[model samples]
Target: MFLKSVFLVYSLLVLRVYAANIMGLSPFKMSVIQPLLSSSKNSQIDCDHHSVKSSKRWDVVDMLKAMAKIDSTVGYEYEVMHWLRDVLEEQGMTVEMQLVEDEHQSVTGLARHNIYAYMGKTRDTSIVVSSHIDTNPEGNIPYHEIGEEIHVRGACDAKGPAAGQIVAFFELWDASIIKEGDVSLLFVIGEEYNGIGMKTAVESLNATWSKAAIFGEPTENKLSKGHKGNFRFDVEAWGKKSHSGYPELGFSAIEFYLRKANTLLNAELPYSPVLGPTTVNIGTIHGGVAANIIPDYVKAEMYIRVADDIEKVKAYVEELFNTEHSQMTIVQYLKPQYLSFDVPGFELIACAYATDIPYFESIDVKKYLYGPGSISVAHTQAEFVTVTDLYDSVIGYKNLITYNL
Candidate 1:
């Protein structure tokens, strides 16, 4: 243990000393793993000779075309994964599919693979830029496309960001800028439900990874320092199975839940100035056995998005329900969870949604929330990523790398 502490202290000092030479951002906490990209004078090994001549705009558009062409919703990323693996293989890049067991088998229904296409064992590792490959479940969602407007699913929330990362990494790698090491790319899976893919990867503790992790979410490609997260749990109202005629034999769990919901609506949750406000939305609710029979069970799914002590928030939620719905049963509990990004110079907005950042905090990495398109267009029937936005993301990404590494 003493030796470990000594090494940890040494690591931080080494990284701090080298960070100034490379202009890379340091982590919030002490780092034990120093970057291997550092050199004698300057870490910015400019090898513009190995640069590719492809326009990032066209690259993004092409990637959107490819991502939009496939459907990787929940249990079905295999089709798109195979196609992407083939594309990477064609470029002589080594591709591997990280298969993680499905923990949420009752919900996800199948195992998933976190696809990776690495350029090589680059020794000049600078920064690890990553984006999620899987997309939200897009079913019979209606969309439109006008002149120059290309409408499709997974166009923004991720596909475009993924495109930007892929495009940039390939260019740098091919140009030999990343020949020795210093940079790598990581594309994860299962960001929506639970961070199963990232979790699996972290467990592997692969040595050939990057120093810091740049996570791409739909943030208009702006660098976010850090933000809040959540741990969501379920609160259930209980009743009894009885005949409809014998109303007294069963209490209405739905009614109990409704009562609890009314209280929450009237309550004002604590909020931080930075993260804005704490809010809750009961997205899904179900109760009753049949129209004639008195329902024995009722469940209400609670979603709480927060920037402060999310675990405390979860406890508060439980207290809120338990105090009111005293007789109710909690059929299921899913705590509100995610790590919010906060970056200076970034336009702050209330993110009532969730991301994969929370699951990644256990690893020593730099988290950036940036991507193409607006979150407003995400999961919408008319979902689409602006061609201009995709190009903009590439430029922004390059700028981020230029600033940090």
Candidate 2:
């Protein structure tokens, strides 16, 4: 106990030095700063100690609503990232806007960034709380409240959980339950599409020694057991074009593409009892120029949620699509990802969606997935999360951090 107390004091002194660097103060000046966890600033605080006073507060629902109003679709996440950086800076945390354009080409011609932040400017942290800030482009709804529920794009998918994480960090800091270098926050873009944002972060972030990480996604406030893998491909075919009247003279590209698609729809794919069945989705199709004209080109995009081995799924797809009339191109592929859910009292769930967790497979960290809301309504026009869920998730995240630390 004596050694532990001595180490705690040493850690606080080191944190003060790092804080001085971030606040542009000399080490001597930072040392003279008021006591930690002053009750005068936050009279509402319930921590054990009491000292000075301050007035700074944050809310999960407000943060969620603010982010939901912004359109941070896959390729256009600069504005949302900027907003989060400002919020983190306001809390006196050291923030780094890690550029992600080099990894994935931005469609908006604007720079993309991943927010990497830590209190007191300490690069190394024991725990990391991360979530994506991007949403699908189809439903970019503005912030609006429907009674106890808040309806908006990215509200349930991730922004709500991200907001909860931010608030949880603040509460922990305020109560002095967690101090400098104990935890870090990372919010990345491009998760709805290719996961380029997190891919970039795992390659360059300074937290190599982190022991555990919590990823925020829609899990209905339960701890995720694992999630299905992904295998996406595009099928393209070409045929001669002619007028509708000359039916015999031209070939129908759409018809040919549909035949190939039917072959896949009827094929039997692998499944597992734990992760469930592998699912397929024919996402998009584009080919015809006009109703009267026979189409010269056709293309169909397909995605698979692989519950079985991704290699086996990929091999089956490759052999099935091998033909002269059509060409198949693989877009994205990832194996199923399993996560740690040993925390007692939390319900366990397996998701059918893919996340950025696979990108960190090589890292040795206890990865966990937990957040508020349901994935069923995430990408739809009905996307939303309740105010109760948002508040619950703040506590959920705080529990996970406290347990891990």
Candidate 3:
């Protein structure tokens, strides 16, 4: 037992020396020694720590975990915004809130606010790091840890990038590298929906002088050169209601909708060499009151990921819906956006998803989209972002800020 104890002590001494070399700490320092000796008995010491002493640096994982705990789905972003505002204020940054009126106030009964933080008054040449603060409502599930990956609703879709941006901003602030009004962080809401938060911010903030903007979205750590635009509409078919048993007495709205939707699905959509072909999704369909009654009014919401000019696609859709019995209403239309970046050591790729880039087009700033995580799992139940990816994104964002500055 005594020999075993001696061997254990020797191993610990060797590890302590290695940790001191890596962490650049004095091995004999009391702060280091006390923690090392008590670490065996202390539950506070994490097994993976280089030594018993806890690092004072801000942890991206901890911050992400904190942010993930708050439910920030669409219209329900008040709690997360409050938490972010407090954290930014504690970091000595000037924080401001842009109140966004909820269009569904009668249904949700919740107010929405966009949070913006910066060191000083905005400057004309400032660099902006931005990301959405909300996740898809369907995926607001609890976060869980699996190995080095964190599984959560918004872990990859946005919250991960948001946390990374915050950490990068904090690091820049700590290093005194960025002056007041040199760099800013903008966390907007409702990107998962119609981008109302960004639209509100652009008009209200009047930040046209900003030279560059770095948007955070899941790109698996690569930079996005361009992304597809979005166009949404609902096709509603109306017909006379009749008993299901009656064959030719009344037209079936469901049949009419199916024929139109099939025609659209089979039609050759405009294709782009970079963004590929325009895609359509029959997201939701509703019509009949019962199985026994014919559906008098049938409606199907369709979303098109447009790869061509938005107007061209809109015109094509209108042409497709020109039938006398059918009608289409435009829901949302955002033009395809192209981004540019000169950051070294990163591969550039194209994204098929839409972002808030369209809303910021009025500012005339060079925009770049980059972040950790993959888009494949963004809105899925198994959404996740690796710890390494999250940590690396902090450096990525910092590099972007440094380059812009």
Candidate lDDT values, in order: 0.61, 0.82, 0.80
Ranked by TM-score from best down, the candidates are 3, 2, 1
Q: Candidate 2, residues 133-249: lDDT per residue as tens digits?
A: 989887567656789889888988899999999999999999999999899999998888888889889998756646889999999999999999988889888888999899689
State how far residue 135 of model 1 sits from its true place (Å): 2.0
lDDT, candidate 2, equals 0.82
Cα deviation of 182, candidate 3, in Å? 0.7
Q: What is candidate 1's lDDT per residue for 54-124, written digit by digit as tens?
A: 22222566666645555666556655665566556655666777777553652556566776555564422
Per-residue accuracy of model 3 over 1-405 as CA lDDT, tens digit each:
999999999987877776554333455531334243223532222222312333244478766766776678887787678768866776677888888875365146777888888876653337888999899877556657889999988898798999999999889878999888788888999888788889988888755445789999999999898899989888988887888899478888888889888888998888889888889999999998888888788888899999887787788789877577789998778999888868898878899999999987877778999999999988888899999999999999999889888
Residue-pair clashes per candidate: 39, 4, 0
- Model 1, residue 405: what's the lDDT? 59
TM-score of each: 0.74, 0.83, 0.84
Over all chains combined, what TM-score does candidate 3 have?
0.84
Please state every model's RMSD to the true fold in angstroms. Answer: 17.2, 11.9, 7.8
lDDT of 3: 0.80
